[model samples]
Target: MNRTNLCIRMLQLLKARGKMNTTQLADALEVNPRNIREFKKELVLAGYNVEEVKGRYGGYILNDQYDLPVTIFSDEEKDALVQSYKFMRTQKDFKPLTLYCDAMDKIIATSKISSNASLHYMSNSIELDKKISSMIDKTQQAMNHGICVVLSYQSLKDETPIEFEVEPYEIIHYHKSYYLIGFSLLRKDYRMYRFSSERMFKCDISTRHFIHDNHFHLSNYIGEHSLIPLDLKHVIVRVYHKENGLRLFKEKYWGNKLLPIHKEDDYTDFEFYTDDMSNLYQSLFSMMDQVKLLSPDDVRETYLNRVEKIINAYKG
Candidate 1:
């Protein structure tokens, strides 16, 4: 009901109906003549191209066409979407914001879910830490300001659990777990610690705050690096087929980088790189005849050694 909003809404009315006079605009907006005149000038300044007549029957009109779309979101629904994805039930993914937006289009289109609408599912599809999600959300804000995190943690080497101060660098979700990537004061190095395993977590004053990078976004961190053990190298295996698989790759990976390297009706090579070759190794064993380790000799040997161990076990 704000006068400014009403004035803006008047354009939508005029776009629907051919034109509207200053009197009608005033009546619609429930404002005075001076207000309507001011609104008209404001609209003109906003590139509305307004025209007006001076006579008694004279009225204001739009000199140009309006093509912009008018869209609205219900307050409750917007709140729900924000709540669902903001934290706890957060939709924070390893995908970049740009990539996330692209994925959101696909997610909304395929899932038939509204972008700003609340998510309510009959069947549970997501599993994670609710409290930890909230904490992580806070951690992101704190990371921007170079704050420290004090969380209850248990180490495998230690018999009892302890709370320690650590600088929150990033949060990476992988293999059904949420890990906080950061430099620990006690450990004095970059460490990946589990959030769910923590009994309690909060910021401590004794610890130092350090902003790692403006582009030190956690989503990209997860997408680029996550779920792999230390000292593992990423080996991208590209597979090319004559047809069909490129579309599948685009659909699955949702990127042009992998798809452009392969073409339709041409031999398409499938390429993916991984240091933790356990999954790839097993896959290689199954596709022994079709799949080839096109990259490093060591990568191929790692697969061979696993097969050798299996053969040795079978013989023994």
Candidate 2:
């Protein structure tokens, strides 16, 4: 779209294919010869040398020694990367990207920003776990190459490890966890595998490949920050004050599916749907006295019992 993006895409094309002619680059990038020249100029201006060859089946090539720095980051991309880093730091199973995390802050400062709001300094010293990182690499390779993956997943409830082959469609980051969404041959259906908690003991790219379902839409399968369908149960919470649960529901990061039922000057009734009652209960429990549960007697009872246990623990 923009000059920088076009140049970057061209660089990516050249990097992938080693070299390409004017026609090949034009056809691959879906741009004209003039546009390819313009993209090359932009890349050259950005400190990348684009060599042109003048022969049959010769076009342009990126030099092997030149490395591309991550220079162009929009506000949205910066926010996404920051959030991912924050999530990565929270996972004890893997070491945090401490240097990269610090570098992100420096990049944000150097980059132009329209807002004057204070940024959250989430500096932490943790390193990524090698075993888990290896799984991630294998999973990414499977997704990129359209190949099946063999994984040994260990669930907390299960003693023995479960090994299966799956066709990875997408990798999702929900809350503070990473999940691989794919069609599982073991389950004979589409499912999501959470990498942080479920724990992948072994992951290998298989020679077997699969045709990605073009009709599959990730947003339709999982909500913006939710991994599963929210159609199973409806949860209602009444907020007596605006600064309480109301404020949290209004924030974009809290998920946008919270429906306001009754809106008044001082009080508001909000409805949230989720299949996982345990998760809903945990979220509501964090709010403490700010909210009241209205429906689903079992959920309410569970919340109350948990609260009682907490209170008794403090008292004891």
Candidate 3:
């Protein structure tokens, strides 16, 4: 038989039997074992994840998720379906589209759709950073299968890399950065790890499944803290609304722990939370005449003392 016909037969047989070693496939197709291995390579290049098993039950099998029921769609029907998918692909929220593509990939693969056709119709709208995309893909797979992932995390300050064994809850993209929000086994708490600063090298799907709290929400967790945790401290600052400074603060820096603005004539009290006080102080100091510390006696006095020192140093 021709190579194309033999591959089609091999796929059909694997789908029926769930798996087949090279010897079995070669015998069934009346071909050399090397031919079977070559066919597996071709399947992989065509976007099918053909996984290899080792030891006594060694064989090549399609990924369990892709062992889909047979599908029959005419060329015209597929064209129409892809057109509709293209329209939905243009929508903003990507999860739904991602899900559709995953299922469609299986359906089309089972139906023997050409790779070029699949690529043309199902192109992604969003472009992810290639350096991080592989890690993101692995983490996502772990999330779907309820597996534990080990990541090598490098912080901005730390020279050495740290290992994190986490149960990934979600991958969030915020402000041109990606974050993996997961339950850290080491820290024994829910934490958000920066994906770009981390490398995911291994994933182990334990037979032990996790009991997920239905009430656990990513937004609620992030709402309680800033995007990056420095040294958290509650702060209250008074700002004179000179040239709409309050509006600018609201537009740019407004987030968690920002208490309602208390307006008194020309000044407004801006109560918020911050982890990095040095950065916050520098920002406030630059606005010297327009902003003032409202409370937290020590922080207020510190700002005042710094201003005094700057004034003294520049004495005429």
Candidate 4:
């Protein structure tokens, strides 16, 4: 890490973990023991009250009463913050817009980068519905307070609306949709439910509270679920330059998994991996004339059948 980040991290360690000896701080920051003393000096210079205690058991601690100084940001970091503020400004349902704008202005003022120069990029993310926004706020509050919520959910597979209690663990945003990942009392297992007004009729936070499982890691849980799987299916495709296949690869249309296996004058064989075959097939179909599925007979047959059905529909 850079000197600025290192100093900030040292202060964070002291504030979060309380008193720590130089050796402990050095080990945590992966720096020399002498460097911890230097970091403490830098923090003190930056208007932080870092006090050292005397004795064998004593160590350095931050004065909890003192307020933190305005954090200085690098030019690149300032640009990123400016761009994020611009993106959030476009979100109609963002409730804390005023506070965020004020905070961004103050942060940018302290940096060398001009906020006006960084306004070149705008996000095309879908705006959240007002109902969904309200749902997210309530769910966040319930999760913060460790309370259970009664959700009236209408599953697509079933028309009847079912009421169930869920212990909200995390709210996930994927593919322009919000999902609540929680423990379902009805199923007695973890479940992921979409947060849409069409699907979720109601969500009421109950007075009942439950102890949050400290061992529940969101990444570990998502890995076990199919929403974000760890196992990826390998895919191979022969791409011709005729239909902008090479341009798609250049633009990283296949995400981070696109790789070249073999190259020829007229065509190239590329390999990639994905957990979502449906999305992959859609992408391939969009460029069907320029790409051919070479391996994985089952997947190839499925793709061919879907194409055939589409052709038959057009013929009819």
Best candidate according to lDDT? 4
lDDT for model 3 comes to 0.65
* Candidate 2 C-alpha error for residue 142, in Å: 1.5
Q: What is the C-alpha local distance difference test score of each model? A: 0.53, 0.65, 0.65, 0.72
lDDT string, candidate 4, 129-239, tens digits: 888888877887787677898999988986789999998877766566778878887887778888898899888897767545433434444432134544566789998
Q: Which candidate is the best by TM-score?
A: 4
Give Cα distance to truth, residue 95, candidate 2, Å. 42
Per-residue lDDT tens digits for candidate 2, residues 200-260, read 7778998876644433444445532345655556677787675555676454222236788
Residue 282 of model 2, lDDT score: 71
List candidate 3 segments past 4 Å from native. 1-128, 155-159, 185-189, 198-220, 228-236, 241-288, 298-316
Root-mean-square deviation per candidate: 18.1, 15.0, 13.9, 14.5
Ranking by lDDT: 4, 2, 3, 1
Q: Candidate 1 or 2, higher lDDT?
A: 2
Of candidate 1, the 10-residue stretch with the lowest lDDT total is: 115-124
Say which prediction, candidate 1 or candidate 3, comes out ahead on lDDT.
3
TM-score of each: 0.37, 0.48, 0.40, 0.57
Expressed as tens digits, the lDDT of each residue in 54-112 for candidate 3 is 43566877774745877788889877765554344333335565666556556655776
